[model samples]
Target chain A: MDSIYIHIILLALIIISSIFAVSYARVIRGAIILGIVSMLVSISLFLLSCPLAGIFELSVCSGLITVIFISVISLTLPPDEKQRKVNSVSMMKKMVLLVLLVLVCGFSLYMLDSKNITFVPLMQNVQESIDTRDNIWNLRHVDLIGQALILLTGLFAVVVLFKKDKNKDKK
Target chain B: MSVENILLFKLYIIATPVLFLVGIYAIMTTRNIIATIIGIEIMTKGVTLLLASCGYFNGRPEMAQSFIIIMIVVEVVILTISAGLIFNIVKKHDSLDTRNIRNLKG
Candidate 1:
């Protein structure tokens, strides 16, 4: 019961941070806010009983992705030139749409009658009682192989691209 | 299913869609390509949340976790390549605003 409340609060924080991230005028600021959103959402995922995913999200999304974005933004534009032109009318329209969607979600949740909602003990109900480690090693081994392949591809691509850029610079 | 689980599930249900919309809004409203990439990242997170939540609901957290792991790897790769492309575009066009790059128009 207490934990559920914590989950709700975290979820709310996630939504708020994302909204701020998207709406902020400065691109770097938006990127930073989006990083905050990822951190909050990862915490929320932990509260919802997905600890592994939450930890990965925190490390990868919040940490690596945010750093990548900040570095890219800084590399491309000077700190003094932080402001980027935005379409105000479209921004307003999107905000309005987002507000409406949020309202509808709240209204629907209200109408759904929380008292009737039910849940099962997800971990306990599993007949196999397989450990998460086993699940990864035994059941999803193929994904692990794929993960290695993609990471190598990414590293190679980054190296090749940066190499090309360096050659261009010298020329 | 416990009450806590359902509550969490419902919360995710409400939140993920909003995240998706906000991501799209971010992409559409921002003139800078980098900002649009930020929006794409947000949308990817939302989808990951949805996927993990559904897996948790079905008592298959490992399945979701495994897939999300793969997803994160792929996402970073995509973002890296795209950032390079964006940098190249800036060099060629001198601007990150999508409107200024009209060379693609037929």
Candidate 2:
């Protein structure tokens, strides 16, 4: 119960920071910050008592996504140079969209408030005392093997499909 | 207003979507391909956050957390591969800008 307020504050921080990421002049920096925001969200989940999702968000998401972002594109652009290229119309469009998004999010929160779904105790009335034995949060052997297979296959597919760029001269 | 009872709903229902919106805005507005990928990552995290919140509120943490784990794994593989591909492209062309990419579109 005392925790809800903390979560609320965290939530506010998440939104504000994301807005900063959106508006930042440095796109790569923004992406890096956005990854931090995701980590915050993961933390917020754990605070709310959702450990599984929290771990996922924290371990796999926070760093992995940044690697993806950093990997996919070089982050050497100057902010002002990029800023000069961004037209006012595009910025205005993003602002307008953000406003609408906020409204919808607010409305959904209101709807959740209309219902009384709080105070949920852990494993309230399940026949499955199995909840204790359930290490759903922990990754296991078969899981790792399955994942390894998937990644290996995906790599193979990429190799088979790598086509050389046919046109190196549109600049 | 008991602080504990505050529902913390705004973070999920509000903040989550806002994060997603901002992420989208970043993706759409940025010409830097890496930044755009970051935007996509932000939005994906926003979604996972919302799911975890829902699972928390409903006392079904496993459902949300497991999904998040799976999502994260998939995203990492895809992201790594794509990053390598994008890097390879840039190295061959000397820039990561979209216009340069379009020129290589043949």
**Highest-scoring model, DockQ:** 1
The stretch of ten residues in a row with the least summed lDDT in candidate 2 chain B is B1-10
Q: What are the per-residue Cα lDDT tens digits for candidate 2 across A116-170? A: 5454445544333223125342433466567778789668757744645558554
Here the TM-score of candidate 1's chain B is: 0.90
Off by over 4 Å in 1: A78-83, A86-127, A165-171, B100-102
State the interface C-alpha RMSD of candidate 1.
3.1
lDDT, candidate 1, at A116: 56
TM-score of each: 0.79, 0.70
lDDT of 2 by residue, B35-90 (tens): 66667777877787777767666656565565566667767777766666566656
Clashing pairs in 1: A119-B1, A119-B2, A120-B1, A120-B2, A121-B1
C-alpha displacement of B96 in model 2, angstroms? 2.8
Q: Could you tell me the fnat of model 1?
A: 0.51
Compared with the true structure, all predictions reach lDDT values of 0.75, 0.65
